[model samples]
Structures are given as C-alpha cells and as structure tokens.
Target: MRCTPPPERRDTAFALILTALFGACILLSIIIPSQICLARGGEAEEMNLSSDTALSKLTEGNESPAQEGIPVHVYITNNDNEKLDVSLFIDSELIDHKSISSGSDQKMDRYLLEKGRHTFKITWWDEDVKSSFEVEETRDITAETSVHLYTILNDKPEEYEITVNLVNENSRELEAFLYADGSFKKSKKVGKESSAELGKIKLKEGIHNLSVRWQDDDTKIEYEKTKKLMVKRD
Candidate 1:
C-alpha cells in the first residue's frame, strides 16, 4: 500500500479521465446553444401567427356593413332645342361638367354619399338652379335612389319671334295646334321621338290666351291644354 502505482498505468488512467472531461464539455457547449435556438424559433413562429390573425380580422371588419355608404343615381337631360353646357355640383362642390345636345339625356356616374340631407346644383353655363333632396335610411347597408332633371325653354324674347315646343313621348303620332287669344296661330306635326316647334309669331305685348290641341293616335282621344302667356318687350 505504501508503494506508488506503476507510471504506465497511472498515465493511462489520467489520460482516460482527461478525455472523459473534454467530451462532457464539448457536449454541453453544443446542447446549450441548440436548446436556446429552439426556444427562440418557437417564439418567432408564435409572433408571426398572431400578426397574421390580426390582419385577417382587420380586413373582415373593413368589408362589413357598418363601414359601407349609400349609393345615388343621377340623370340629367336637355329638353331644349339648343345645345346645353352644364355643370353638376354636390353640396356646393363641383363634381362634373357635360355638353349635351338637344333632346338628349346624360347619366352621371353612381355616387356614394353619407346618410342625410344634401343639395344638388345644376348650372347651365352661367345660369343656376339648385334643388334639395333627402337620402333616407335603408334596411340594407347601402340605399339606392334616382333623380331626373329636364331643361325646358318656355320664355319669349321678342315680339315678332315666339318659340313654343311640344314634346311627344308617346308611341303614336300627334297633330298639335297653336292658338293665341282665341285665334289660330300655327300647326305642327309631332311624332314619337320628336318635338314640334312653332316659331316667329306676330303678337302684341299683353296677357294673351294660349292653347294647344292634340289627338292621340293610340287611344283615338283628343286632349287640349291651355295656358296664359304674358309677352313683354325686351
């Protein structure tokens, strides 16, 4: 017992001990970094999944009914014989301008509006005509409505020249007679998709009686319309 172990045996034992310790240190260095990497990867995946779910919810909310608006349809027409250059305005803001020919119609693009009262303005070049309407609530998310505008020329500018227009919207032909103050003035033949005009009549400046008589071809019935005209010198 007092004698020391052999050098060879001692050296071999020490070499084995050192080798075991080195292997343990190398295994610990690799395993610790691997566990840390796994933890970080899992956290990153969870964060990305949460972000995608939030984006999906936000997109669905935007497409919901509570975020939608109302829809409006507007139609404009020029019933006069002259070409019309007009502008459309909503709430005093100009939206569009168009040039429409005689007896032609123009439809504006469908617009989205908030629920409430609004003012629509139609300007014929420099002249102005403003109209007000309301948009009511609907059971659906968006409400649909329509408005029509027609420009009619009904004024006399001179004593020697007078213009009267008769519009025929029926499917049958019509014969229109014009009378001023109980006297026959002129006659015009107006058919479907056409208009009749009685121009250049000699009349005095005063309150006068005006009458128009037409026969309906489809119903074989006669209709008469009478109005009072006041001619003034310009």
Candidate 2:
C-alpha cells in the first residue's frame, strides 16, 4: 500500500510543476518559429537619401547649356508587412535611396532624362532578411529596363520606328543620331544599360540617309555610321 504525502509536500511539488510548464511556454514563444524574414528599414527613422540626390529636376530652356530632356516618373508600392530599403539608379548612376514603411508606396519625383532608352534599376531588401548585417552591401537584384510609348513622325499614313540596339555595359554611355533628307531629324542617347530608339516615322517611300554616332568607351575613339534605308510598299 502507498502512503499519502503530507499536504505541504504536495503543495511544493505542484508549484514546481507549474514553474516547469511556464518555462516551456516561454521557450516556445522565443524559438518555435526559428527564423523570421522581415523587410525593415536600415534605421528606425523614415527616410535616407544620398548626397547628390535630386528629388526633381527643372526643365532646361533653349538658352541653357543643359540638354533638353523628358521626364521619367517611377511609382513603387510595398505590399509586405515589414519595412524595406530601396535604391534607385539610372544608367548605373545611383540617384536616390530610401526606406519605405510597410503597406505603403513611394511616388518617386519625376527626373529629367534625355529622350531615349534608359535603364531604371531598383535594388531592395528587407530589414530582417537573413541577418541585419549589411544586406545592402551584398544586394543581388539586377536593374530592370523600362519601356514607354513614343510618338513618331511620318509622311505617309503608315508609320514605323527604328530601334538602335547597343551592347549593354555598365561603364559605357552611347548615343545615336538620325537624319532624313540631309537635315537633322532625330537623335537618341542610350544610357549605360539601355537600348535606344529613333521613334516611329513614316518615310517618303525613297532612299533616305540614316546616321549613328557614339564613342567607343574601351577604345576612346569616336565611331559613326551612315546607311541608305529604302522604304517602299510591300
């Protein structure tokens, strides 16, 4: 026959059991999920920008030395629950950077850019991705190219565009110029990582002169090309 324990002893054993159960719950709360990936800001603050960051650029007038350019607008939205650090680049040049809060969006101010193809790259990371340690330094996102609808000039009702494809290089900038009937008509500046286009145009259904010019970044020499483009009915 088993003998019953004293009341005091039974009460102490019950207290010990209660303490063990509480410790187990605390451990589970801290370690059950193991890892959490969150996109948090580099700092607790709202924003951080580069030194040369220009939110927006004013249009250049004809007398101004700056080349006249069009505006490029970018809109980004964060659908995640955590904060995110984002960097923006144009043609391999770092333009701006900021940390956006969770469930919000950033409408990047319009930047003046020469009319042509441009590479708009955005590298982003979460705050709690892997380790807090320098995730921005080891960023792995490649810049994605953007496309826009461009209007062209044409003599006939039918119209077509001439696209200038260039080798993609982060260190090189290229430009292409087009002339029709011996007069300058169109020109395009290709950013470091983008392809240029001459826009859509309808020719006069005859032999026309087309020229392209750019400097060889590797060779440090100027290059030019002239071609005779024939336009006719199929």
Best by lDDT: 1
lDDT of each: 0.58, 0.47
Query: On residues 108-136, what C-alpha lDDT tens digit does candidate 2 reach at each position?
Result: 56677765556666666544334221112
Q: Which stretches of candidate 2 lie over 4 Å from their true place?
A: 1-67, 131-234
Worst lDDT window (10 residues) for model 1?
9-18
Candidate 1: residue pairs that collide: none
lDDT of 2 at 55: 15
Q: Give a tens-digit lDDT track for model 1, residues 130-233.
A: 33222222222235776666666533344545677766665656677777878887887777656666555766677777777776665667776777877777
TM-score to true structure, per model? 0.35, 0.28
What's the true lDDT of residue 158 in model 1? 41
Candidate 1 off by > 4 Å:
1-67, 126-142, 154-156, 159-234
